[model samples]
Target chain A: MSEEQDIKKIMHVMRRAPHGSIYTYEGLEMILIMAAYEQDLSVAFIGDGIYALKKDQDTAGIGIKGFSKTFMALDGYDVEKLYVDRQSLEERGLTEDDLVVDVEVMDASEIGRLMNEQDVVIHH
Target chain B: MNIGILLKEGPYNHQAADTAFKFAEAAIAKGHKVDAIFLYNDGVINATRLGDPPQDDRNIAARWTELSLKHGVEVLACIAASKRRGINDEVMIEGGEITGLGTLTDIAIRNDRLLTFGD
Candidate 1:
């Protein structure tokens, strides 16, 4: 197969909040591993998943290891397609400035279009 | 079409596992190849042979083993997630193997479709 054909557009959809459950955390690990394969990988934050990108998160009191900082490192891993649903952020009273990393804030419809283009969509 | 299933929930507590299994069965019935079932997160618990649900309840692990043996579907559990949940080779049901994320990456790449079932 051609090099271009080998690139599968895989999107990891984050729909749960961080710390409450292991979905977001384990999903991050899956993204990190997939990033190394050099495929077209993207991560979308929707619903409470927007909280995963919120800045200054401290898990010290929650007794769970804080991994919010890991989002900032994803760029270095060459997995830069980070997207946030605009409605979800606003509904939660958060702005792009409140996020720890730079992301493309788009409407849910726009994100849905991108999702349609993906070869695989994994929701967490 | 060659379809791969990524199951992210354990049995009983959620319908994700059952739904994924049914989807696989339906896909196979439709003359499609169900390539494999990759278990992650709480989904890794589905591989335990030690689970002793009430006799009246569906035996989830046994169902996976049957799927693997009868239909040639590969049943895989993420090693990292399995280790964290106290699942190992000894506790794994027949045909269920502990694998890495790299295997999952391959499943995503090579399969014609990769469907994820979870909360």
Candidate 2:
């Protein structure tokens, strides 16, 4: 198949917080590798996943290698499409300004519609 | 329609595997083809034949094997994830394959939908 035809709209849905478990960190790892493929990639931060984009995270106290900075570095990897759930952020009392990275804050229905359009949706 | 399932949690410890299996079965019943079941993270443990759960409990590995045997499903465990969890080919159940992430990319591209079930 031609390279152009192989480009599928893949969305990685991050639903967990960082540090408490390895899901979010490893989920980011998967995104970084997939970024190299140059596909239509977008990451949705819902539920605890919004916490992953929180600013000033100090993992040194937790003794785990904090990879929250990796989210900031996604732009360099050409995986700039980051979407944060509006309700999730509001429920957590967080706003777009509180995040360390720039993201499109969208409603759940909008994200759900976008998800239905994707060829692949990887939930983490 | 061709569907691919990505199971990210281990059996019993989480409901992900059970949910994925039920979804796969439901998809097949609906006349959709289940292209493959790609196991990542602790989900790789679902492919091991060494599992010997209590008689009253559901044997997750055997369930996957049955799905593969009866429905022609391709059960695959990520090589990188499997290696770290000590799930080699020798311990893999029948119809389960140890493959790379590239294989998952192929499954994603070929399938009509790639549904992921995780904790």
Q: How many residue pairs clash in each candidate?
A: 0, 0
Tens-digit per-residue lDDT, B1-119, candidate 1: 99999999999999999999999989999999999999999999999999999999899999999899999999999999999999999999999999999999999999999998987
Clash pairs, candidate 2, are: none
lDDT value, candidate 2, whole model? 0.90
Report DockQ per prediction, comma-separated.
0.94, 0.50
Instruction: Give the C-alpha miss distance for residue B109 in model 2, angstroms.
Output: 1.3
Roughly what TM-score does model 1 have, to 2 decimal places?
0.97
What's the residue-level lDDT of A56 in candidate 1? 94
Model 1 lDDT tens row, A20-111: 89999999999999998989999999999999999999888988899999999999999899999999999999999999999999999999
TM-score per prediction, in order, is 0.97, 0.87
Candidate 2 chain B least-lDDT 10 residues:
B100-109
Q: After superposing candidate 1, which stretches have Cα over 4 Å from the reference? A: none
**Per-residue lDDT over B1-119 for candidate 2, one digit per residue giving the tens place of the 0 to 100 score:** 99998899999899999999999999999999999999999999998998889999888888899899999999999888888899998999998999987778788878888888887
What is the alpha-carbon lDDT of model 1 when measured against the actual structure?
A: 0.95
lDDT of 2 by residue, A1-124 (tens): 5578789999999999887887888788778777777778999999999999999888888788887788999999999889999999999999999999999999999999999888788988
